[model samples]
Target: MYNPVRRNRNIGTENQGFGQNNRLQISTPYGTLKSFYERIEKYQKEVRIINDHEFLFIEEETRENCHHTCTFDDLESIIKQIPKEDYGDLKFIILRQPKRKEEILSPV
Candidate 1:
């Protein structure tokens, strides 16, 4: 489960917003790009853009699933919400998803 208050406490003051220091820091695990999108749709009910290159996604508690997809329109909508700014280059900090036991056992 995603606990906003607890997550904030763990991240400390460093993670108050998406791009406070000219960087986009995503605090969730990074699964396959496809899974990432699916989780976003299922867990995140709302997506808010903080700046031209920074966005915040609030997610719901969900069981980990590998099957999921995010649409192009959905991504576009998110990009459009960000307020325009002259923030130089953009940086992303995404957590990598852990491999499942089944994946490790499956043959290539």
Candidate 2:
């Protein structure tokens, strides 16, 4: 007997796995926006959440241009804010920083 209802339930489980793969590795300790804001503020650095998988940290802000960068310490700070149990399926965290204007303007 082929049960359509049973098949649908199995399909739902498969979909759940897909969603899990797309979530951020870091889980907020307080589970609130206010907590996230406060924790980030302690760094005294500007951050931009690019997506569930990535974030950008701005290191230098200037009148003409801004420098976005990340360091080992930055990653450590972020990891410290998350609970160990919340890491779920996250193998790595990628950080991207834009090149400085001077670097772009200057030749190799």
Candidate 3:
């Protein structure tokens, strides 16, 4: 499970809104996490810009959270480190909410 408190970092998205702490958590294997990165680094042979600062990446995690509208360039380096294997319990998504682009981009 993704325990930010255990990892000692408030990284990633918050499944809950302000004043709420309903973030979903999942248990991930240490070997899976390590190999995931190893494969990424080896397969990362290209780079593409998403926004001004971010780039595209094959981000994987235990929870299926919202995918940021824009990608960052910095993630390219990080993606390369992941291994090309199933991340066990981790829910892997190449992009964030990939199927909801139109809905996400539409004006309310």
After superposing all C-alphas onto the true structure, candidate 3 shows an RMSD in angstroms of 19.9
Candidate 3 lDDT over residue span 7-101, tens digit each = 62434656334446644433346657453223332122233532223333464322255445544454554544555352333333354222233
What TM-score fits each model?
A: 0.22, 0.25, 0.18
Q: What is the Cα-based TM-score of model 1? A: 0.22
In terms of lDDT, the poorest run of 10 residues in model 3 is 36-45
Clashing pairs in 1: 30-95
Model 1, span 1-108: residue lDDT tens: 877667455355655565656733333466555542334332444434444454444434434664324543465466566545543444432222323432454322
Candidate with the greatest lDDT versus the true structure:
2
Q: Model 2: how far is 24 from its true place, Å? A: 30
| Model 2: per-residue Cα lDDT over 1-108, one tens digit each | 987667545455656555555643334565577532233221334444322434434333223453335564667678667865676445544333323443454423
Model 3's number of clashes is 24
TM-score, candidate number 2:
0.25
Model 2 lDDT at residue 66 = 37
Query: lDDT (CA) for every model shown?
Result: 0.43, 0.46, 0.40
